[model samples]
Target: MLYRIFTDKEAFEEALYSYQTNLSIILAALLLMPFNYLMEVFKWQLSIKSLTYLPFKQATAGVLSGVSLGFVTPHAVGDYFAKIWSFSHEDRKKALGPILVARMSQMIPTLAFGAVAFIVFIQRKPVFDDYSSDYTSWLIPVAGLIAFLLLSFLFIKYGVKNKKWMYYFDLIRKLQLKSVAQLVALSSVRYFIFSVQFMLLLSIFSFPISFQQQFLGIAFMFLAKSVLPTFNFFNDLGIREFSAVLYFETFDISAAPVILASLLLWLINIALPALIGLFFVPQFKIDPS
Candidate 1:
């Protein structure tokens, strides 16, 4: 028998390798996109609550303007400025509040995923007996914590740092606690769902990795982005690929299929969102003066 002729170890490896070549996982990852899109809507909901009691249409416009700008500018700074400008047209201070909060919602899950992945990376390394002195890998979580604390302090102390409490400060106060908590919670939910996107890519290729491992893999990808903020052009493509390669090496995971999976996820996760922004030609009623 072929099974008897081949050693059991060899037989298992053959089965594993063969199993890794199927497409079921990619289909699963694709299912995550709608969840990601729905997560965006929650941000819209929070933004609406943070604004000047405007109807959903106006707040939606502000959200669209923010996203549209995020698409055009390097690193999505354009979206931040666009939101500020769009909201300022109605209530500059109030509009700025949610725009600020929206960013917090966006990053929480990114950092959370990265933190867990870093832990997994460390654990996964001893299995291979291949070690690198990049202890700086540990810095991602530390820096993220420091940065989050610093920003939170600033938002709490100086978000309305001026005495115009009635106009901006008080309104910002109303949003400060709830918005931050919601964004953080929402971001975590978003990350879990987004991992499904990655799973789909691997499923397409018949890769046999767990969703949790995929999450850690994807987390490391994002962590690498935070580690090197200056290589701004494709928003961490090289960093992401390098990180993926690093993780893949641990499982004796081949480079080609992993790279393929990473690239496909990137296309789905980033490029698609930017493309969606193109359809957001909003009509705002801000004065021409």
Candidate 2:
């Protein structure tokens, strides 16, 4: 069973090991790490500050710890668990508020960018040329998506009037429009940085793609990956490589190198932070009492 579970991983490692890489590209990619991480730390610090005050340094620790917890658990729900544990007993109970807002805020950029990316790929890309899905054909689904989002917002907006649903989403009630807007802006900056990093890495590996098409691929791949829920970090391993291979192949990029690039990205962005998070885990204290 364990061997079967790891079969996909074995394939990924084999490809990653066999691929040649540019040292300059690796160094350039590494340079984005601190800035990328700092953005997340900044966003988290600001979000949590709305509920409980935390200095930047401590917030960094919490964010990393959350990263680790998120890494091991599906959808990183453990992120919330680790966060609340970091607080005192009394605060632990209330900590869910900020954590919930922080998480949803993080998704704002993904949703916004993902929506655009989906449209771009569906319309402009050659692969989608025969897809039979055109911009006008896009209206119904887009309208449905918009309606869904609006309904979710309306629930959050007016749920306060009804006690049954209000308490559960109470934190959302405190999330004023201005604050949500700020979170979206902050998240957008982070999303742009991460997208650039992915492109840099792809170029480093010599992905055969034009700049415009490359972004179209990136948008769809990132959007698709985020749209699905992963059972574990490794669960998305196949998804990332497959998505990259599919999109890049439209431009004649080979699969092996693309898979390797995706692996390196996972190592850089997810695995490294998760390893760092392990150190902060010891500091987590849960006080259910």
Candidate 3:
């Protein structure tokens, strides 16, 4: 995939020169990488504190290990399991709820911003004018949102009440409203940091789009990548590139720089952390006994 993009010697040189000239910008984006994971670590600490006390160092290891494992698993399901194993064997079962809550904290910002971005993308793009005019075109996102909310309400109101699910719900019930709010706030900040990092990378590639357009494009891309299911075999390799290229193409943006930027973002945000997580993988004790 990447070989095809870099095959254009001219485009590759241009990107290389751009990175050289904008070294500060590139560094700034890279710097945010740690802070992004730091936010996640904090969220993990907060989420699991209800069940057990997790020091910052251990939480950091657990979060990165989750990232490492999640990188290869479909929908990052391995993320949940990795974090759950961060606990002692006895607390692992109850750890499920907090892990979920931690994930949901980050998801809220993505969905909220993504929904807004989706609406804006469709509205602003002339290609979507026909779909926008047709009322039915709006049904997909709206229906999805409604169904998500309905299911969430049902789970909190009824699903947790079932005795069979008490093991999972017990830790969730222990979370204070204040703590949940903190998680949301931290997630929002983390989302903003990574989103800005992406925009910074795009700027390095000289995308020529306004801040508004870049933001809308990035948000929509994240939303698409999040909601769409990827095959386990693919491990989410091409999804971001596909989403970014698809959105930016409407702006007459070339696929080369966009793809490069997306790939770099993945390298900084996902691949690097996943590599770092390899060290922590040994720390995860699978057997409580």
Candidate 4:
């Protein structure tokens, strides 16, 4: 009986390996999505151009610095700080002013779309059939997202002028309104492009979900993965995959396809950038200011 049980376990393992291997191959093919990431870089450069007269190369460096730092740092704090650091070499206020406004602008559309999806979740069911489904239920995420937007906006608008939160709030007062508006528009474009990339990734999986369903699901998963607590230094690997599994359940998506889509996205969005940063690391030098 013991030998039979061991044999069964081994067979199960083999089947699992086979499934993962096949899925990985499909995902590998889809990793070409990185080519689309350039849209995000382009949008960021445009945002900077709206604010100040920057050379194309310098504006691009800001984007590169942001993306590289975003991958390495938890909660993207590193990316923001890196931007400030890079820009401070020229002018401290110039760097901090645009970065904060640009960050807020980017979050607006994400929070807005996520709010819609959250409401849909609340109307559906109280307890999620999946483990953490209830916790991830739409109401709280939507509320939190909305609250974050309000507070961030207020902070950027008023708090920046007042020293209530931190001296950093003063920086917001310095931002040019036209520049902020331009950044916000650029951010919206970035968000739309990202949604499009996910739609394409889903198509590669042959998932039957509609474009709205696909984008909404992808948005929720992306927000969850970005905000979720993680123990790893790199991307929140298992947490993100788990979120994908739960989010995809609404569309009757299978674990294999969800996993494939998630993996493909991670490889392109995070892995590829991180890998390139690795090559660029040797070239990274700290200039003594």
Query: Could you tally the backbone clashes for each prediction?
Result: 12, 0, 0, 1
Candidate 4 clashes: the total is 1
Superposed model 1: Cα runs more than 4 Å off: 1-28, 53-68, 84-89, 123-171, 205-210, 282-289
Scored by Cα lDDT, where does model 2 land?
0.67
Candidate 3: tens digits of C-alpha lDDT, residues 1-289? 4465547778767776777788798788999999999999989888887678888888888889888889888778888888888767575778877877777767777786677677767666532344655445555665677468446634753567677687777777777768877998999999999889989988876566678778878888888887887753335768778888777877777777777778888888988999999899997778744
Higher-TM-score candidate among 1 and 3? 3
Q: The CA-based lDDT of model 4 is what? A: 0.58
TM for every model, in the order presented, reads 0.69, 0.80, 0.85, 0.69
In model 2, which residue pairs have backbone atoms overlapping below 3 Å?
Answer: none
Candidate 2 TM-score, C-alpha based: 0.80
Q: Give me the candidate number with maximum TM-score.
A: 3
Better of 1 and 4 by lDDT: 1
Local distance difference test values of all predictions, in order: 0.60, 0.67, 0.78, 0.58
What's model 1's TM-score?
A: 0.69
Question: Which candidate should be chosen as best, given lDDT against the real structure?
Answer: 3
Model 2, range 128-204, lDDT digits (tens) per residue? 45555564565555566645654665567665577755654665666676766776577777777777777777775
3 against 4, candidate with superior TM-score? 3
